[model samples]
Target chain A: MNNKVPNNRAWLLVLPMLVLVAFSAIIPLMTVVNYSVQDVLGPNARFFTGTEWFESMLNDSALQAAFLRQISFSLIILAIQIPLGIGIALIMPKRGWQASAVLILITLPLLIPWNVVGSIWQIFTRGDIGLMGWGLRELGVDYNITRNAGDAWVTIVLMDVWHWTPLVAMLCYSGLRSIPEAYYQAARIDRASKWAVFRYIQLPKLTNVLVIAVLLRFMHSFMIYAEPFVLTGGGPGSATTFLSQSLTTMAVGQQDLGPSAAFSLIYFLVILLVSWVFYTTIMHMQKDKHPHGGA
Target chain B: MSYQLENTQRGEKYTTIFSKVTPAQRRNRNARSRWRANCLLGLYLILMILPIYWLINMSLQTNSEILGSMTLWPQNLTFDNYIGIFTNSSWYMGYVNSMLYVAMNMLITICVALPAAYAFSRFTFIGDKHLFFWLLTNLMAPPAVFLLPYFQLYYSVGLFDTHIAVALAHCLFNIPLAIWILEGFMSSVPKEIDETAYIDGYSFPRFFVKIFIPMIRSGIGVTLFFLFMFSWVELLLARTLTATNAQPIGMIMTRTSTASGIDWGTLAAAGVLTIIPGILVVYFVRNHIAKGFALGRT
Candidate 1:
C-alpha cells in the first residue's frame, strides 16, 4: 500500500482520465454552479441571484419530503439486500457446474437495462394482466402500485432488491472464495458452530466486500431514477419519488435551472459526506483488526 | 493393576469414538444441509426468475390475451411481437443506437481509465488522493443534477443528438468506476512486475500494452462489463442528450408507453430483446464477474 516513488510524472499517465472526467464531470458541474447563482431570464438576460436558490431549495417542503423518503428507501433496501445477498452467497455452490449455472442465472437481473427492469416489473405488477398484481388481486390483497402509495413503495423496494441483490451476492461470493481453505479447516478442528464460523471467519473476511456493497447500494439507491420513473412516474402522489426524481423534475421537467442547480450541489454533497463516512469507518475497522492467520 | 487401568482408558476412548455419528447419520446430515441449501437457492431463483418469466410470457402473447386472462403461461403464443420489433425502424434502430453509444463509451472509459488506474495503483504524486476522490465524486453526483447542464453543454457544442454525446456523457460515471475497479486489480499485482519489465529494457508503453495489460486482462474484462452495463442501462442522461437520431432503447420504450397507451406486447418484446445482449456478455465473462466485483474495492 506504500509507494517509495515520489515522482510527479505519474500525472502524465493520469492526464487522460483527468481530461475525460473533466469534460464529462467538471465542466458540467461548473455549469451547474454557474446556473445555481444566476437567474437565467433568457440567453442574454441574466442576473446574479447569489445564494437565494440554495436557500429556497432548502426551504422547499416537497424536496425535503423527497429527501426523507430517499433516505428511508435507501436504508430499507440496504438492510434487506445486504444480509439477503450474503445469505445467498453463503449457500451458493462453491464449485462445479451448479456454481457457474447459478452465477449466470442470478446475474441476469443485473444485466437488464434499468428501464427494462422497470418495464419488466411494470408488466409483472399490472393488476389486470401481470402475474404478481393479478395474483395479489385474486388473493384479495387490494394491491395496486398506481393507486396505493404503500404498494408503490413496496413494489419499488422489491424491484430494487430483485435487480441489485445479485451484485452484493456476487461480491460476497468472491470474497468468500478468496478465503484460504485453511481457515475452514481450523474452524472444523475447533468444532466451531455454524454461527461461530460465520461470525469469526466468514464475516470478518467479508468485511471489505460488504463495505463496498453497502456503499455502492446506498449511493445507487439514493440516486435511483429511471426504474422508478418508468415504473411509477414518481407518482402515486410522489410516494416513490426519490432525490433524483425530484431533481429531474426541477431541472429538466420545469427548467428551474437555478434552484435545481443548488439542489444538485446539496445532493452531491450528501452522497460525498455519506460515502466518506462509510469509507473512513470501514477503513478504521480494518485497521483495528489484526490480519487473520492464514493465506 | 497398571495394565488393567491402561486397558480401561483405551476402552473409554473406543466408546467415545463409537458414540459419534455413524456413516449413515453423517450422510443424512450432509444430505439434509445440502437439501436446505438447494431449497433456499431454489426458492430464491424462482423469485428472481418469475418476473422475467412473466415478461417473456407476455412478450409471446397478444395484447388481448395478456389483458383478458390471468394465464400463468401464454395460451396463444405468437411471435408477432418479436416480428414487430424487427420490422419497425424505430424499434430496431433504438437497439442499434443504444449499442453504438454503449460500445463507444466502453472503449473511451477503458482507454482513459487504464493508465490512470495504473498511476493511482503504482505511484505517489501531487494531489493524487484528492484528485482520485474528486474523480469519484462524479460517480455520486446524480445524473438528474447534470441533466439540464449536460443538455445545454452538449447542444451548445453542436454534439447534441449524436451517439458521441451520449458516450461522452456516460463517461462522467463510467470513467470513475472503471478507474476504481481497474486500480483495485492493478494494485493486487506486485510492484516487482513493473520493475521487471523495465529492467528487461522494454519501453513504458510497450511494457504496459504487452506485459501489463495481459496481466490484468480479467480486470479489464470486468471494467468493460461494468462500463458496458452502466452505459447501456443508463437512460436519464442518454434520454436527455439525444432526441431522435441517437435515442436509446430505453427512451424508445418510455416514449412508446406514453405516446400510446401501454402496448404491453411490444413493450414486453423490447424488454426481452434488451436482455439478450447482456446475457451473452455475462455468459462469456462469467468467470471474471465474481472476481472482478470483489476486486472493485469501494
Candidate 2:
C-alpha cells in the first residue's frame, strides 16, 4: 500500500458529504431526539417530559398491533419471493434475443413509481370497473378486496410479489450467469443430473447475491407505507394497517408526537436488531461450509 | 496447438455420443418441455401485465360507466379523463413539483456521494469503517420515523413548503445508498492509476474529475439513476415536507379521492403519466443494474 501520510486528505474529500449529511440527516435526527423527550403544545409552548413519551408509547396497543402486522407481512413476502424468484430464474432462457426480451418484461414492473403501483392495483381490484374483479366474477369466484380483510391481504401480498420478485429474479440471474462455464462442463462430464448440478454448483455461487436481495427486500417490505396506504387506506378495520401507517396516523392525524417519536425509535431499533441477526447467521452458516473466505 | 486439436478430435471421435440413438424420444421430450415452459411463461406474463392493463382500461372509461359495469374492457372509451388531468392545474402541478425536487435531490446526492464514496473506497481514515456503517443506519430507518423532526427542523429553518425541503429530506436515504453503490464501484479501480496521476503532477480534484470519474462513469450513472428513481416516487417525507407549493404526484394521487368521490379516470391517466419517465430512464440503464450490483465484490 502506498503510504501517503494521513494528512487529512480523505477528510477533505468527505467534507462536503459530511456537511450535506449533517444538515439533512444528523441535525434532523438530533431534533427528533430533542422532540422525543419534550412536549409540543404549540409553536410558542414547549416543555421537557423526559422519558414519559417512551413510557406511554410502550403501552400503546395500536402500535403493538402495527408492529406485529408489519413483521408478519415482511416474513410472508420474503418466504414467497425468495423461492418463487429462484424458480423463475431457473427456467429463464440463458442466452440469445429471447432472453433480452424476457428480461425487459420481467423488469417492467420494477420501474413503475411506488404510488402508481398502488393506484394501478387499486383500480385493478375494484369490483365496479376492474379487470381482475370482472374476471373473478366471470370465473364464479367470490372476491371483494375492498371490503373483505382476507381478500385485502391476498391482494397486497400478490401485489408485492408482482412488484419485487423481478428484483430477486434479476439478481439471481446475474449470480447464476457469473458462475464459470468450467463448473457446468465438469458437472456434465461427471454425468451429474440437473438437480445435482444446481444443488452443488449453482446454489453455492448464488449465496451472496441472495443474501443482499433478502436484506434489501426485508428492510423495504418492513417499512412499506405508500402502496398499502394508497390501496386500502389502512382500512377494512386496520387489517392492512402496518407499522408505518400507525406511526403516521399517530404523528399526523392524532398529533401525538410524543408517542409517535418513541414508536419510531423502537421501530428503528427492531429493524436494526433483526437485520443484524440475519446478517450474522448467514455468515455463520457460510463459514461452516467454507473455512476459507468463500468468494 | 495442433497437437491439442488432434487430441480433442480423436477423443471426441472415440467417445460414444447418442445424437442418432433416440430421436423419437428426444422429440417427444422436447415437445413436452416446450409446452410446460410455455404455460409457465404465459401465466407469469399475464400476472405481470394484468394490473397495467386494468389501469389503462379504467382510464378510458367514465365514472358512470365504471360504477355500472363488471367488464374486462371499457364499453365506450373516452378521452375526457385524459382531458381533465391535462386541463386542470392542480393535477399538472404534481408533475412540475415532482420533477423539480427530483432533479434537485439528484444533484445534491451525486455531488455529496461522489467525494464521500471516493474517500471511503480509496482511503482508510479514522473511524472510516464505523462511519460507513453508521451512514447505513439511515437506510434502515423508515421515512415515517423521521417525519416529525424533519418537519420541525425544516419549519424552524424557514425551508418548509419549498422544493428544497423535500429534496433535502430525501437526501437522508438517497445519500447513503449513493455512497454505498459508488464506493463499491470506486474500490475496483486499480491503485496504480492514482500513483500514475500523482507522478503526472495532477491534484486530487484533477485526478478525480479528469481520470477517475470517467473510468467509473457506468457506476456513477447507475447510482444517479437509482437515486433519481427513489426520490421521484418516495411519498411519506415528500408529503410531510411540502403541502401547497411542492407537493409530488404521490400526494396528488392520494388527494384525488376527496369529497367529490374518486376521480377514477383522471387518477388512471395521471398514474400512466407518472410511470413514463421512470420507464424511459430504466430503458436506457437496463443493461447497467445487473452488472453494477456486484461491481467490486460478488
Candidate 3:
C-alpha cells in the first residue's frame, strides 16, 4: 500500500521510537560487538583480539552441543505445539459463556511469570511431595527431574508446552473466527466432509496466524532462559543446557565477556536467519495465492 | 388398481426406512462428537489447572504436611504462608517493585510506539521498512545477550537497582512489539479519517487524542497486555538491572532454595500470589483478547 503524496515528514512521527530503540537496542548491541573483539583483562585494561573469541567459541565443543540442543528443543516445541494448538482451537467453543470461560482459563498459564512457571513445575514434578510425582511413584514409575536427564528434558519441554501453547491456540482461534461464514456455508452445501472443510477452509484461512504463531514460538523457544534456568538450572549433567543458558553462564556466571559476546552474536544471527526465512516464505506464499495483490 | 397401490406402498416403505435410520444416526453421531470434544477439552483443562491447583494446595498447607502427605486435598489447611508474605517487607516489596516497573514499561512503550506505528501505517518514509525490521530484530534478540551490557551501562549511569532501569531495559523488546501491534490496528483505519479530522480544524494532537486513540483503544489494550506480560514475567533483564531496592518477585522467589532445602509452602504462596495480578488483568480484558489477537499481528 502506498500514498500518492510523497512526503518524508512522517519521520517526525517515528523519531521517538528510533531514539528509544537506539538507546535500548543499538548501543547495547554495539557494546556486545565491541566486547566480542577485545579481551577485557580488567576494569580498565583491555587488548584487541580480533575474531579470536569468535574462532574459539566456534570451536568450543560445549557450545556446539548447546547449539544443537537449542535447535532440537525449538524444533520439538514447534512440532508439538503447532498441531496441538490447532487441535485445541478446533475444538474450542465458538461463542457464549463457555467460550469466555475457556479463553480465560487457557490464557492463565501464559500470564504467569516465567520463573514461577518453572517453580510450579519444579514442585509439581518432585517425586516426594507433588501430585504428579507422587502419582507416578504410586504407579511404580521413578520420575525425578534432578537425577535423570531424560526426566529433566521432558519436564522442561512439558513446562514450555503448558506455558506457551495457549498463545498459538489463541492466535488460531482469532484466525478461525475471522473466516467469513459464507465459506463454511458453501462447504456445507457441497456436502464437504469434516476433514475436507478443515483442510480447505479453516487451514487455508489460518495460514496468516499460523505463520505468526510458528515464528513467535520458534523465537521464544530459541531464547528460552528463565524457566529452564529456574527449573533444571541446565542440569542433570547439562542435558537441558540450551543456547541462552550457556550464554548466561558465560556472560553472567563466569564473566567471560569476549567469548559470550561472540556467542550472543551467533545466537542472534541464527534466530534472525530462521525468522527471515519464515517471513519471506510465508509472504511469498501469500503473494502467490493472491495474484492481484488483494489481502 | 391393486398394482398401483402395491407400488405406492413400496415407495412409502422406502421413505420410512430412510427417515427412520438417517435422523437417529445423525443425532447419535452429533452426540458422540460433542462428547468427544467435551472430553478432549475437559482433559486439557485438567492438565492445565492441575499444576496451579497443586501450587494453591501447597500454599494452603504446612511444609511438613506438603512433604509427608500425598492426599488430594490439604490435610491441614493453613494461611500461614500467605500471612508470612503479607507481613514481611521484603516479600511484599517484591510485588510492589515488579508492579512499578511493569507499569512504567507499559507507559513508556505505548507513548513512544503510538507515533512510530502511525508513521509506519500512514506514510512511506526513508528507511521505513529497514527501520521497522530492525526494531523487530530487537524483539527476537535474546535478552541474555543484553544482560551484561545492561548491567554495566545502568551501573555507569547510576540507574542500577532502580525500577526505572528495569523498565527502560524492558523497552528493548516491548517497544518493538507495541509498534508492530499498534501498526496493524492503525493501518486498518482508513487514511481518510485523519484528513477529515484535519479539515474540520482538529489539530494533530487533538485529533489523535480525541479520535484516533479511541478507535485503536483495543490495540492499545493489547499492546498494554503484551508489555505488561513480558515485563512482569521477564527475569533476566529485570534481575540483572536490579538488586535489593528493586527486586522483582520472580527473582525473589529463586532465593527460597538455600543450603538447607526448599521452602515449599512459602514458595508456593509467593508463586500463587504472582499469578493473581495477571489473572485480574486477563479478566478485565477477557472480552477484548480475541479481537485483540486478530488485530495485533502477533
Chain B alone: TM-score in each candidate? Answer: 0.91, 0.87, 0.90
1 or 2, which is superior by lDDT? 1
The DockQ-based CAPRI class assigned to model 1 is medium
Provide the TM-score for each candidate, comma-separated.
Answer: 0.94, 0.90, 0.94
What is the number of residue pairs that collide in model 3?
Answer: 0
In model 2, the Cα lDDT at residue B22 comes to 44
Candidate 2 lDDT over B81-184, as tens digits, reads: 88888898998998899999999999988998899887876677787756776677777778888888888889999999999999988888899889978876
lDDT (tens digit, per residue) of candidate 3 on A73-136: 9999999999999999988888899999999999999999999998999889888888888899
The local distance difference test score of each candidate is 0.86, 0.80, 0.86
> Model 1: residues >4 Å from true position, as ranges?
A282-295, B1-19, B258-260, B296-298
> Interface Cα RMSD for candidate 2?
4.9
Reference interface contacts recovered per candidate: 0.75, 0.54, 0.69
**Candidate 1, B1-298: lDDT as tens digits:** 1121111111232223323544455555667777888999999999999999998999999999987878888899799999999999988999999999999999988888899988888888899868877876788878888888898899999999999999999999999899888988887788898899899999999999999999989889988988888888888899899988999988887655565477888889999999999999888888888888886542
